[model samples]
Target: MKHLTETDLRAWLAVIADPLATPATLLAWLEGPLKKFFPYQAVILGYGELTVGQVKTTHVLASGHDQVFLDYLPTAYETADRSSIKWWRTSRQPFFIDPENPPAYASAFEIDEIQRFGLGNVVAHGVLNIKANAGCYFSFSGVEGPLSDWHLEALKLMTPLLNDLLLAHFYLKSERSPLELDALTAQQRSIVRHLAAGMDDKTIGRTLNIAEKTVRNQLGKIYAQLGVHKRSKLIALLK
Candidate 1:
């Protein structure tokens, strides 16, 4: 791996710190300024399940790769014991694969299949929110040597920001609009709006001139109607 100069590190940090940076914009930075340090030929980011036989990319950004390969991921790519999924299950740490000596976890068939795509190295890390029964992944692929210690360190440094941005992306994608709030009654909608404003049930109840128990009951009904079990999930959906 190449060593990043102080300036390079600062630039990478700037990209990560950008409050308005979307996943696509971050991906563009990964492909450009940070390429020298990470050297990935392709990249992907999204949320889904691997253990339950469901893999989907709610958001994806890739370069120097075919779209067909990504399109096949939900079906064909995931069914196989892909390296990323296998690693994600066993450990929370990032994992990597190189053509020289692939990990024992990856099946020979999977290795051959990956190599056939002209990829020689790959690295992946996952952020699991078990309560949500879902997780997010960041995958980087290269056509040459394995990722180096610097690359791993860089990713580790950026992991927190990546997880935050990825979750925000997921929430943004799934957030319901005001029109979608029609599913709830006016009172329920008012409660939801208060929740969105970061009010607790007690505070909301007091403000709305209702008892806390009433607020709880209303929240239960709202949760049932929205198919969510927790206040946080409901807030994310409504946000």
Candidate 2:
């Protein structure tokens, strides 16, 4: 790793104090100035506590991710026995997962999940909460090549600020979003959950025991009520 330029250091610290920070802003920073030092082709972020898993509180950001992979990410990350978050907290070091050469801590299921998503060479670190449970965590996938010792060291500089940006407001799922979930009917709510879980209309229809046409029609109504025009936007809000 090279020395952090004055520009890079400034860019890194400047974001934590950004009063108008949002996930879009954070993504810009990550894909922009931050990438110069900490390189990754794709990244996933989780905003919540440790020792517990819930899709509602998870926020994942990955490039070119399909719906099924997005739905799988949070569950795979929260694997208590083998997650990088659990490994890092317990070992006080950054954790690494390589698909072809799995680490001792990497579970078979975890590796399979990563491979299934087509993400290679995962490296993870986090900014834990008061009790060192969890505040936010991140995994940088498809790293250009080997992640060096210096790369892990670089994470020490950035994780907290990234966590700050994440917890403050990462995206639609942010606590700040004014979701009118109460506006939904019970069936609509179920559909929304299924959608967030990466179910397509046909699958949702099967699950709800409704015709595919009805699922599409109800989705139209749900979209109108929620002010989202597409499945991706709707999932972003609820996932």
Candidate 3:
């Protein structure tokens, strides 16, 4: 596994931090930035399963007729793995599902529905907690090999980038009009993102490198301001 150079890492950070870049642009950025790190067809699955979002872009490094497959099985793509997707929701961790752990229809999944979709060997990373409120599965298939340590490391490196880019996107979107989200602090926004990701007080605290009590207090203030009583309600208000 080749380690990413400091200069390259810095370049990636700067790219993701750029304000003018949209998620579609960032998807393009990912294809270029991590080309050598993995071998698979990539798609940025937005809030829905299989129904590619507006952000679909592929690195030519990947070899697959992904677009053709998508066109042929559009309906199956949208609903085949909807329930399975929630696994990423609560764990908030990247999961690589293989033939060894293939989907079972008994588990509320439409197994035949997916195999007909013509995808193979899934590799996916979860994007936890963002404003505009959606969970993204950065996935790739059509590869031959167990995902390597380098692949996992690359995905891990991208997770926080995805978070911050989405943060910038939403903050800008919210502050664009008569409403001013500029008044909200960065910490407050971080709190909102984690809470929206379905994280509880303890997980949010650990992720933010703060105390659990601090997380609770932050949520208390956020709820009061948003006029919400539950986490779901708070997330709904924010979205």
Candidate 4:
């Protein structure tokens, strides 16, 4: 068993728990003080509010991850009916995952997330609020070593501080207009209307007389501009 230095823990907590810390400073903190003990190439933080049949992100941030990874995450696990996906539920314990051999009994959605992200070695942890049926999830990928009790312990120790920091970040606005929706070109708006109407990419392309791939690509831009991660959510936002 690798031993953890108390000094490492103390400094990590001190940096993350700083009152001055904000979303803008999170990447530096993660790559700085936190890396002293926990090393990773990318980290994703998501706060979700669960409903009867689905879990939706209320806020999300990805540091050192790609734009495609961020834009596709919300719908990666989505089902036709949006049924309950086990991975969406919280796990109080940390997960030590290696793509060569993943954690046991990992849900399909969880596995899909790993595969979709092209994640390397990962240690994931989260804190759940039972009453509200919401939680904060942390996924630290591109880890370089085997899973250890030390990594789990470090993440568990930092869970509360991380949760609070997530709450402090820019929340997914359920009621507000996204960053640049009003500025969308007419072509973009047409794509959005077709998407929101439940039309598939091929169908939308035929209607708009564009390539199917172009339709998909334009929808991606609409999602980013509207600040929505899921198609259903985007439709609701536009309504």
Global lDDT of each model? 0.70, 0.71, 0.55, 0.72
Poorly placed runs, candidate 4 (over 4 Å)? 17-24, 75-91, 112-116, 171-239
State which candidate has the highest lDDT.
4
lDDT of 2 by residue, 15-84 (tens): 4445534565667767766675567878777766544642234455555456677765444344464555
Q: How would you encode candidate 1's per-residue C-alpha lDDT over 96-167 as one tens digit per residue? A: 777568877777766886778766687777687777656777777773464566666677666777777667
- Residue 102: error of model 4 in Å? 1.7
Pairs that collide, model 1: none
Q: Least accurate stretch of 10 residues (summed lDDT) in model 4? A: 76-85
Candidate 1 matches the true fold with a TM-score of 0.61
Tell me which of candidates 1 and 3 scores higher on TM-score.
Answer: 1
Weakest ten-residue segment in model 1 by summed lDDT: 75-84
TM-score of each: 0.61, 0.59, 0.44, 0.61
